[model samples]
Target: MLPDFRLTDRTVPSAIEVYGIQGNAQYVARKAEKQALYAREGAPCVEWIPPDDLASVQLPPAA
Candidate 1:
């Protein structure tokens, strides 16, 4: 799957996902699947649920 932002420079696999849609059930399911895939691959991710979780989402330090 294509991530919203792929952190290619990180020492380990990493990505940033911007979850802009929350009202649709299919989109929500896909989001969960993607998150699970990333976790299973041992990649660090920053998920930004805009208008709410932006401040809470902490990005990983630069490599």
Candidate 2:
């Protein structure tokens, strides 16, 4: 499992920012086509947030 460095209870991200949204049909169509291709290939699309963006993701104190 990928760790959430935000120290959040969010199991999954509520939103993801996609690459482009210039309102151009061709661009949007190409992006969708690529997504479909990846899906058919059983590839997973993932997003990322730098660890530095979060407050803390340190190891917990030992008991």
Candidate 3:
């Protein structure tokens, strides 16, 4: 018999820093879409799957 398992939870952050309002909304939508797609494809984890353009950003040093 197959072992019982529970899916991991992936939740998007409530706020994001983008160039503009539209960009922030777009980013959130993209994140949600990716999570849904991975869930549909039966992914065990979503950490390794980076979102598009996310890897290209360079953050400033922490004050």
The models' CA-based lDDT, in order, is: 0.84, 0.43, 0.40
Model 3 residue runs over 4 Å out of place are: 1-23, 48-63
Q: Which model scores highest in TM-score?
A: 1
Candidate 2 local lDDT, 23-55, one digit each (tens): 779967766775676568654444232433444
Q: Over the full model, what C-alpha lDDT does candidate 1 score relative to the true structure? A: 0.84
Off by over 4 Å in 2: 1-18, 47-63
| Candidate 1: tens digits of C-alpha lDDT, residues 2-53 | 8999887766657889999979999999999999998898878888887775
- Once fitted onto the true fold, the runs of candidate 1 whose alpha carbons sit more than 4 angstroms away are none
Arranged by TM-score with the best first, the candidates are: 1, 2, 3
Per-residue lDDT tens digits for candidate 3, residues 1-63, read 111222223242111223222447775686567556656866433232234466654333322
User: Which whole-number lDDT from 0 to 100 does residue 54 have in model 3?
Assistant: 67
Model 2 lDDT vs. the true structure? 0.43
lDDT of 2 at 7: 22
